[model samples]
Target chain A: MITHSNVWRFFTKPLMKTRLAPRRGLNGLAGKDIGDRQSRIIFTVLGFTALTALLLIVLFLFLEGTALFIHPAEDGSRVGLGDFILGSFWYPGYTPPEFGILPLMAASLSVTVLSACLSIPLGMGTALYLSSVAGPRVREWGKPVIELLAAMPSVVLGLVGMMVIAPFMQEWWDVPSGLNMLNASVMLALMAIPTIASIADDALESVPRDLLEASYALGATPLQTLMRTRLPCALSGVGAGIILGLTRAMGETMVVLMCAGGAAQLSFSPLDAVRPMTSTIAAEMGETAVGSSHYSALFAIGITLFLMTFAFNLLASFIAGRYSQKGYQAA
Target chain B: MVNDPNAVEVKTLNFFYGEKQALKNINLDIKRNEITALIGPSGCGKSTFLRLLNRMNDLIAGVRLEGKILLNGMDIYAPEAESADIRRRVGMVFQKPNPFPKSIFNNVAYGPMLHGIKNKHGLNRIVESSLRAAALWEEVKDDLHKSALSLSGGQQQRLCLARALAMEPEVLLMDEPTSALDPISTSKIEELVMDLKNSYTVIIVTHNMQQAARISDKTCFFYMGELIESGATDQIFTLPQQRQTENYITGRFG
Candidate 1:
């Protein structure tokens, strides 16, 4: 008893109803059309493809990284996780290779801290300038240039650090080598400044005009309004920007590899050459034999770097959520 | 002219924004300790005239002014007159309630702090008294530390009123301060404004004819940037002399 006209009515009846109510009809068709359904299915598949790829990559990383603690090395000795992480010495090519990652972890932390010290103040200052101090014409030209800095390749920055900054430092301070922790930190700070400035500028600019007007109407000077009202309101967003910048500085590979001088020493001095975790993995992974203890150790270092960045990301989101909710409501 | 001790005297006042004039030549005297209501249709320059009283129009770019606005016999438009001092002495409450993102205490203390009253005890005293003056002290006394944004709309508007009062202004300029509120809140604000005239000169711009008639002692009707009529509120509402004022008041034309 099912006919072609019945099928036609099923589709055209809703279409006719929608056509009668211009806006609702269009929306209904958008939600129910065959072409739209097909596109949605395609997009879902594409999304799942990315998710599956990420999961597979993470699974591979864990399997290869944990193998170092389970598999016997060429010398028929299994390295324990505690010794691998806590060992102060790391000589992968020695007769009895020592793989203590504590020195690398220290170097990474130091450089990230140093870079943050340099970048945070500079980035926040830039953000404040771009958001409030600059006029419309100045902001129109200036914002894109700041964002363009974020797009600059890290390798180009590494080359500049190695070629320009290293020689300048060597001649100025009479250091043994220009490539040191200070040089690496300086380069990383340059890389982080753009990200911090752009995001923080957006935050400061988004502070309500009503607040500004209220402040002005209150007899407060412009500087007073900015310092007391605007800055406090945008604190969480600015904090998130700084944390993200620090994470980027900590995980940077090319800048540290080229500018850090690659010396694995647990020294507190800024001028001392250092080998951070990221550079070690990037520099050693190519030469280390696949499935060897050295290869697994490199993967283990990757896991550590992943976890560090993950923790920082969590902290950034926490700052953004908690303070933003408590700070302002557009009543 | 004999100097009035506590009155704002406007003489041939004209205002322009870029190429367009927003207010035509006008002359009026706003008395001290009296509620003056400015009633007009939208874009009739009532708000512009109110803002000019406190020099709030100066914040907009490319705006020009002519003639003299005298506050207590001193020309407020003189170059030596600082806008900041004027604003503090002539505080404003905008149409929409705009509380700072800070706590209720901080919100009320903001103006005093800007003027450098950093003492904890002094700030607490000012906050409490200002809230009481705004009729909001009892409701918010328990939650002084809570964020100002958490307050209800009516409470927030009262908080804004308290904030303006904290500066201890001589004149209060309100631009439709209760237009965005519900009826209850509007009545509360109306009562508060009526109470405020005993301590401060109040100039308010309102589109609501009933509100203007109820609380104001003096009423000015503006049409097309021109002051159509000015008189005691009762006479203006009951027996408007000008045809335009009478027509508009009787719901004939805007």
Candidate 2:
């Protein structure tokens, strides 16, 4: 056997080499039976480009937003963003860039708070009616109408706010017969209704039917069941819905621009004219020159809006996740 | 302990879901303080019949009933009768265990809470005693604040039993209470059901032939939404008169 290793090796070499002929047919493919390398490269390039598009958008916003704080013209000094944030008078570039943000905050928060108060109860009630009390046919008809309100354009919302809510507030509440926080808040509530109703309704519907039946079996009235069981169980989703609505109200531009009374005055009176951060950004951005403190300030406003909405959306997602987890346990 | 002519009285009971008939001409007399088992095949209306004890059928849509179901000798289906009040006296445990997403303490105390018992000590007492009766207190007494969902399937089923018991209802309706459970859980539920008959009237619906044999005193065999035969559990299992019921019971056919 030892001797055959060396003697037969020479004879077997030709048979092993010539048994299968080498072929070079698949020139562009990775292997004779496999796909080409260009396909994978093309796919990877496409995927990276798609991801970078989103990344570039966020990066661009952040980059432009940095100028909102960096005022290179004023002695090449960095502008203190806090002054714009805290200052109550927000008349940007009117001789010195009046950067009082408190008035704008008051305007924004007043509208947002008032709108939330108006919508939460109404929307939660509507949600309860649709999810727990209403018949299937009624629910089917009611849900789409509520969602349609959400699908409406913000400009259309602004137009309606100007036409409807402003006059109504003036006539009924005896508001100062002008654009005010109350008018804008009313419009915001209208805009928020769909978001609140749809999510709250989903939350309520997500509650286990057997739990409702169990409550009913335990002699709980429909009202009692809704108040005690369904409401608590659906509180998470309801909270998420409320937060989503709040973010919408806070970041709402056109409605507040038109109806919130664009006055940079710090006051709690819903009847008085108000200027919100979003309105300030929208009104000042077009006329201001690039690299001007006012221009960067607008981007700064955009950043503030972005951060605020991002925080609210994160909170909403957290709450919604918890609510759905509760539902999962019940399910 | 309702001192009346009969605990439950049904006369000319006919129930239908759309065009499909569920219960046909069911006239039943459910005696007080006894376990009555309603045995049938799948979709044979045993659970449907159980739901009528307290008008639980009111939850279902398009469920038509042409009959009267009475409890404690009162005409329960009368125009003035309150289904909610009737349900309060008739606690139900479903086929699948469904506990609230609350603590075990709260789960046991929920029924009493609904009836306006707000005293903390009272609720605690009720919760403790109900869980004790259901044989779940020892396993859960250390962590009553924990969510009921953390318990195993058997424990959750027991917790549901405790929940029902907390109400101190006169009549208890169980719809396949142990079908979703393992053999051990099934035995535990059977024991609880047997123990409960000392004070409460128990009505159960089961597809398991052996369960009907073991737990029920009076057994009602239903077929195709009609009551085929009803007798003592001994007679029904040992010597059923109706051929279909005999065929159903003696492993011949469902």
Top lDDT: which candidate number? 1
The reply for model 1, stretches above 4 Å from the true place, is A1-33, A328-331, B1-5
lDDT (tens digit, per residue) of candidate 2 on B29-56: 8888889999988888988899888788
Model 1 DockQ, alpha carbons vs. true complex: 0.52
lDDT of candidate 1 over A84-153, digit per residue (tens): 8888888888756777899899999999999999899899989999987888889998999999998889
TM-scores of the candidates are 0.92, 0.89
TM-score of predicted structure 2: 0.89
Task: Quote model 1's TM-score.
Answer: 0.92
Off by over 4 Å in 2: A1-51, A75-78, A167-177, A323-331, B1-5
In model 2, residue pairs whose N, Cα or C atoms come closer than 3 Å (at least 3 residues apart or on different chains), thus clashing, are A68-A296, A87-A100, A87-A101, A88-A100
Error of 2 at A54 (Å): 3.3
For candidate 1, give the docking quality class from DockQ: medium
